[model samples]
Target: MQLADLRRYGASHTIIQSLRDIGIKDIYPPQLEALRLGLLSTKDSFVIASPTASGKTLIAEMAILKTIFEEVGKVIYLVPLRALAGEKYADFSRKYKPLGIKVGVATGDYDSRDPYLAAYNVIISTNEKMDSLLRHSSPWIHDITLVVADEIHLITDAHRGPTLEVVLARLRQTNPNIRVVALSATIRNVHDIARWLNARVLESTWRPVPLKEGIYFDKSILFDDGSHKEVEVATIYDPINIALSVLDEGGQALIFVNTRKSTESVAAQAAKEVGKRISDGERKVLEQASEEVLKALAEPTRICRRLGELVKYGVAFHHAGIHSRQRKIVEDFFRENRIKLLVATTTLAMGLNLPSRRVIIRDWWRYQPGYGMGPIPVMEIKQMGGRAGRPGYDDHGEAVLIAKSRRDQAFLFEKYVGGEPEQVISKLGTESALRSHILACVATFLAKSEGEILDFISYTFFAIHKDPTDILSIVREVLRFLIEEGMIKEEGGNLKATPFGTRVAQLYIDPLSAVIIRDALFKAEERDRDLTPFSFFHAISATPDMMVLRLRKRDYEKLTPHIVARKDEFLLPLPGEEDQEFLAQVKTALVFLEWIEETPEDKIVGGYHIGPGDMRALVELGEWLLYSSYEIGRVFKLRRAVKYLSPVRKRLAYGVKEELLELVALQGIGRVRGRNLFNAGYRTIRDLKKADIEALTKVPTIGKEMAKDIKRQVT
Candidate 1:
């Protein structure tokens, strides 16, 4: 359908002109189907299920613009990942800001209601963030008329899916007239989701660029259509050989592996071959990009150095281990076509728009804890393959799996190349998943009794597939746990959250984590001696919300002595000496201690066998959990624990010792700069107030502008 046809469905001339300005002359098949199903004229919800790069986002854009131009109530766009949230926020803000539409994003600090979002015409947020907003009873939520759930298929994810499901159910239940437009790339149960939402289903297999699936074995690719092509590159490494062949054909490649180590090693090998193919002009551009990646941290870690070197050859590996700044540099360079190849783990498949001309699945089996190596789900494989073809760039995309033998080749083709994506089941049925949601329901006054809680559950996708009796049993168990934990109380026949319960919900932490922190605080207060910083760090690390580091073989020997010496200082109970969980918490706590002690980033990452990115993530979570513990303490009125936690929280946030906390409070000063000024006879903000900019500039790593900023702040 022509873009102008949208005007017939109440679309304004301004909206149609905006589409024209962006060069969108024609709508794709799935978009046309959605519009024909009363997308613009009716209040009914919709599920747009289509292949990647098939204009799924445009359909939502049409709906959003129509609502904005018509002055419909506020709009909420939910994304599955924080990276996707930022991408959408930037795109929407840039596109719609000219139309006088206010766009806002909320992805951090789950405790706040972010009342400023009320001024925004459209808001972008992650699933967890939105859920936290709802739990805090943000008043603007009642004004929302539309919500777009991007990647709705992720409701099947075990860790994050429950929150997404709960957010959708709460939004629908609160605003019966609100319209939802759910988008999914690969889902076999799209119709079931549609029925659950009482919405129309628009399912299509059309792609903007054609896709070809195949299997590679013995340097030959056998396409699913019975055609075969030979890869002439001579290399001992199969992935490098395949990637180089794609580069020879004037196209970029994405290599998908199962682990972070594999991504780096594979990219390192490919970098050698890729470097030989780059022209001098391209090399200069890549060298600049490489330097930017390397300098992302003040002190580069080992992974940073290796990644910087690889990017000089137009190759980079992506995983959660790399810091966000460096990851953004790599993504932007690849999108600009400066980076020829990207090697990544499955994280890259989570709705980033970085597409390549060819996608090579180098590993189909992933390690599952306690389950050994297992085949990846067909849905994830397809999502990775979907990154092959850029909509306007590649005429056709190739998604090929590597096979070791004839038998492996046949299995790869049968299972993945020609397979249908799996059906998505709701992951909201378990006790661990339902505990927080159930508490939130009562905390927010969404439900008052057992029947009301069950009614709320009936709105979830879980209820559609689960037996009512099974759900009832689980709900009862969650309620009992909450009651026993003193988070909820039964008054007469109604249910209400106690002050502790309300605070826990508002903190957006696991109810279990709050309980853990509460118990630790009370126990520490009962003791006589002062608690050390390691005690608070280890206490938070033991919570379910914190992602503790994995214990290595050498960690036991190195950690045993310190743990044993500090046993009395720990807030939580000590496990046996050889216990893996105890050792992991000890290791994680030590990392936090080193961070606050102003240890350099490289040494911490090197000693802990982690990437700089991992350290950054752990620090961020540690800060939040520490602050959550403080908030819990305030609720319970634990005077001593709260007094100690406030300063420790600051130390964790600035990555500085307590003595340097006042100096690090300045705008440009960090751990390095703070320490530099202290050792130079400037210990506090008073010392900075007394010094001139010239004297401050003499300190290491402090430039003239930094010095001026520091002087301006202190004065």
Candidate 2:
């Protein structure tokens, strides 16, 4: 495939002209052929599975630009992360906006009107936002003529894969002629995906910049292409040794560490080493850049701090913990060669445009539940390796793994560096996600009847040619719940979204929100005014506010010192000299702190602490809870319930209160426990004076001493 061939095969002159304008006159022969013949013939959905840092995104952009120039219909560019969507939106907007193309972004953090959605030629969004837009029946959605599922390989992720699959299936069915462009790092099941979508597969192993794979064993570099050499790890300055070598050769580097802390640690170390090598003037320039970067990193969030630290050192880190703006700065800096090195997490591998001449993997195994310190899948590691080369800067890029032992070195060489990626599987049938989306579909009027809804669902990848025996039963039960709640009414042959349904739709909540709200309402009605509004709100927000596990400090001895220091500084009174109450609260918060530190390195969920994913789920739950309560309040005119709940709703919107610290410090109290205690005649420390000691003990397993201690602590 060649650029000339694409011209001969009827590619729009505009696309060719744009490529030329970007100084890309010579398209790699294979990619050019794929665009000219392979993509042009496709009528079904297809994925371009290729190496990381390949021109897969360019292919997607070409398809999208073609669709935009051909008609007024909208193009939906779906990415996995909010940051990526924002980055892509800016990229596309800068290029196309001046050319009269309007690009809009709808990510998780922002919500705008549907009218604006229609006005934009391209809308870049996260999958969740896209799902929300669809559920809200955004008028512009139907105007979509093209959908690009970037990072399409995520269809295999358990938590989000089902949502992506359902959305894609729904979009394709709604507009049979809509062009679908699915881009992914090389996956094992390109054929399976192609067969499912009935679209042509343009699979490539070609790299615009060559990537060389090697293992560091016994201080030796062992190359994979039947070429072997020894690189002593001990004699090597650090992972930055290879990075400095690349830069000295006039190329940049992207070093991936498994954690944010490691990212910062490595960047600091690399900057010191790289600093010693540069001229005084160059060092000053780096130091100036580093100062700006440090300011951003100090912003409290993990990503900002990491990037900030890296920028100060003329290096930066990329991860989810940092805010989006800081991540963008790092990306822009790297893209323009302002920053020479980036110590990042696996997030850097996910379709971001920054490429480097060297990629060093600090750790290959991450901890996960049921398997501690397990090997990363070959596919993911490959994606990181694929980012090793820069198209214009380097003829070859080096990917190095630091191996502690020969066995480890062998594992890296044979299993990760030399292996194919795993097959992509469908997540359509997962109960947790499926149940929510199914209810969402009913609420949105996409599923109108038991039979019609069933048929519509059958079109999903989950039900495609699979036995629906259990699925049918599940859908029936959900529909019955809808009817019982008066959310839907069967009229003639169609099921209609009643007033309640409309409210849920308007609020953009998950069905699980309805479930939680119904439970809360039942409890409220059983014992009127017994349930504190904040308790319900907390329940809804807890999942989303779950913190990442903090990494264990090197000195467990320092833990107590830090706790004592914090209490002294804050002037927090303790129950006794031992300060058990304060200690307990510190421990609880530490649990969350530790969880945040470990989450990136350990794929542990529900690991004794809550994290961002859990927090997101909770936020959605809270929104749904409020929406449901509002609807019920409207129906029965329960003004009091609505009034009492409003403040709690406001609290949830803003965030958990600092008073939650006092609540967390109470003995035998978790989030739920604190909520229950506060609701049960114990709203404040003074209220404990009014309670019967024995009776308080009897309240959910508290004993006499525990009750006395709680009271004493509160006082």
Candidate 3:
């Protein structure tokens, strides 16, 4: 259908005109198929399963825009990542908010309920954030008219799939008439997902930019269709040469490496080639972007220092290890073609809009300490390929996998390049996922009995193809555990959540974590011992909600002595460990101790051999776990423990000592400035309130303007 024809499907002339203004002259085949299937005519669900760059996002935008203008209800677009949420929110707000539709975004920051979100006509959110909203029972949720689930193929992901499942299930239950539009990459058995949603399936392999998938082995590209091309490259093992080849063809390239270190190493190596070819203007843009990255650090971390070096050469690496602000700078420069080559980990495949003309997969295997090295899923291989063909960039794109020899090339091509993706299955039936979900259902009153709970879960994609008997046994076991912990009471064959259980659900914490926290508090109160921050960190780390530090053999040897010294403080005994698994909590607690003691970010990263992202994630998770632990103390009536844990949460949050809590509570001050102020004799808010700007500016980390702002806050 042409852009003008969109007016026939509830689109106004203004909307059609705006599409044309943005260079969207016509709808693709998959979108036209969706329209023909009555996508805009009724309040129905749909699964638009199509190849990447097939205009699936456009189809979703059309449906949501029309619904918001024609209907008087809120619309939600759920994505799997915070980055995607931000991207979609910016896209929708720019296009539709000018049409008088309100748009807002919610990802996380758990302190605020964000009740103001009800004022918006459209809200973009992460799946986990939407789940937390549903658990909170947001009042506006009941009025939702449309929900767009982007990357619905994530149902195969073991860790996060179940959260998406529960969130979608609850969205439907909240409003039985709500329309769901699920967008997916090409996965096998799309019909299963369509059947689960009770929606019409619109599947297509059409792409605006066609893809050429092949294997790069022994200086030649072998295509699946019996086509072969001999390419000139500088070094057989140098991925940079392939990228340089693309640059010579007047196109960009993306290199997918196996690890974060490889991402930086490859980006740096490629920059040496690309740097020799960059224009002065391009070098200036790259310089500005590199400066933005360096500005993210008070004293640049190693990742920032390396990123700064590469960006100046029109090259960048993207991974979770870099800071978010630095990541955005890299993405912006790459999008504008200032950065010619980007080396990234698998994170770049998970729904970011940065696309390239050539995608080179440097590794097809990933290493996990628990599982060792294993081949990636064919679906992941395809997802990485999807990033090659942007909607409007190139006429065609190339995706090649690196192979050492003909034997490896033949095996990889047969297993991945020439094979179909695996079917998407439900991970909701897994014990860890189901335990929290089952408790959520009972606590939120979505289900009052075993039969009701199972029936509700039966709507999940897991129940569509698998045996219900398996989930039944698991559900029963989880129910027994909940009852044993007094989280739920069974009376007259009906399950009811206790007050503590209701609070736990309201807090959006795992019930198992809550139980763990409660037991620790109970033990402390029973023993009548004073608890320290060391013990508090250990207690919180024992819960699954926080990511524990991975201890190496040397770490185990060193921390065993640390744990032995603090034996009397812990509610549970800290065992000296030989492997990472046993004394993981002790190692995590050590990190927390270092954090509150004002350890520099670089020193923390160096000591742990972790990146900036790991330290940030650990601190954030510690805040949540500590907050939950404090609340758990209330459940057990441990007043003293509550008081102790409350301040520790702030200490963890700001990476500050206890004396700096008052200063960190304000908007702009953090550990650096807070410590400076504390040492300068302005130890608390009252001290700041009474101090002059000159006195405040004498503190090393505070400037005249910042000191005035700090002084003004109290006056």
Candidate 4:
């Protein structure tokens, strides 16, 4: 059905009537139907699982519109990414502004606590921001009548899944009657999710456009379900060749690659092949588009110059490293039919709303460290497949998977095309996650007594493990830690958060941060010099941004200079070492970094970057440690003494540390080398006494030549 017909159908519905009153006419059919049923149904919660490019967002918009019309309370539209939150905020503001529905976006890093947040009818935010607001007891959140989770299936993500689960549980507790609309792609455990949320499941395989799936192997098409024909893979390229066959078919094509490097490679190869076919005019436009794409992909003085060269021939790449604005620009060009082809990573699979006539998977397996090369999950491949078949442009869209061997081709055809997506599992009970979140609960007053906390945690799927005894043992250790920390005081058979507990809660730090801070404080007591809180914070927060010990291309070796420099300053040793104790610490740091970096940028719930979360947790732990260390500082009620303990807080907030500032002010020293010297123990001119030319060279990372330079600087 046409969009006009869908709008007309929506006109009769009460929710759509309200939306129309606000001047919204471009309602997609599936969205309109889902919205209408969501409003009319008795279910408090509902799940809308549809393919990518389908109007899943419109379903959310309709619910927000209905909530505004009913005047019950505020509406919370939760998205997976900060970029998505910004995009949705703009869209909602444009549609809802004239109707007097004030829209506000809270992504946490910017203007986190807006005073007018409560006044706004619609609040678009990342899930983490919402969690923070809930933890901080933001007044606006208590009145939320509708909660719309955009990527509900992400609860399976090990790093981020726990936060989403806890947030949902907390929201349910706060407002049992709240209307929840969970949107996802085709997931296997929709029923279980429905049961968990007590929501109705609305699952549909229908796409506004039809998708044709096939496998390409040995230059031949193994199968084409659309026409039930077996043609060569070269013939499958016929349509692409046809698009290039004439200059008039001006629209661009999007090719999905599994890796960032491959995106550039495929685009370059396609451009070379297509360059032989297209006219000068077409080539000019393609080259310009390709240039824009290359500039987006290039970074730090054109480090990937070879990759960028592909774009000169009218090919470009898209991936997370390109930056959000660049990705958006590419999407806009493709939408406007300005660019011809976009080679992108699996990230293109998750609901970016970009459509193309043909989607190709160049590689089915991606190499991961330790795990080696494994097959791409079927769900991700299917999501990319769904992106094929642009509505209105093509009668049928094509999704091609290029396989290497006969067995590989069979696996792709059977597992990706025919198999169901995996079930979304909970990662809540993992020892690390449980310990951290339980501390957060104690700090935030979510769980007061040991029994109360255990009871709440038992509601999680993590509690459903096969060994109940093992679970109880884990819970016991967590309780003991809390008791020893004095975060919880057992009084009259009930556990209450002490002042220390309340402070940690208000800070919204992870429990692990407290442990780290306590350890740092003990070490500091052994040494007479006061450890700069900011130094500690940066040390803890600096995740390895540039190490790829895993097998990568030879060119990746160029990154060694940058990686070694960061590792030296951060005091991070290279991966190969027999010292188990130091290795264990390095492993912990790596795990923390992985958690921080791997957290989906879109999934940061409450204005918290898992990186920043780790940092904030450390700051809170430092504060608690300071209170424990100097009772006089606590008694005098001196802010600066406590503040001085955690200098990293200011450094983190400003992105400039006092030591860095001091180093930058020095003559003949640049920021890069200044940081190097400072990390090497020359913090001030007085510390130069410790620096001898040869002795400085002997320092773990500093070489003899750098030691000579340090001696000259001291002189």
Q: Which prediction has the highest lDDT against the true structure?
A: 1
Question: How many residue-pair clashes does candidate 1 contain?
Answer: 0
Provide backbone clash counts, one per model: 0, 40, 0, 15
Each model's lDDT comes to: 0.89, 0.64, 0.82, 0.60
lDDT of 1 by residue, 520-594 (tens): 999877877859898899999999899999988888799989987898889887879898988898899999999
C-alpha displacement of 69 in model 4, angstroms?
0.8
Each model's TM-score?
Answer: 0.98, 0.75, 0.95, 0.73
Candidate 2 root-mean-square deviation in Å:
12.8
lDDT of 2 at 116: 67
The C-alpha local distance difference test score for the whole of candidate 4 amounts to 0.60
lDDT against true structure, model 1 = 0.89
Q: Please give, for residues 640-715, the per-residue lDDT of candidate 2 as tens digits.
A: 6566556554444333343443554566554434555666657665667777787678766456787888778766
Tens-digit lDDT string for candidate 3 (608-647): 7777877887888889888878876787689877877788
Which candidate comes out best when scored by TM-score? Answer: 1
Ten-residue stretch with the least lDDT total in model 3: 573-582
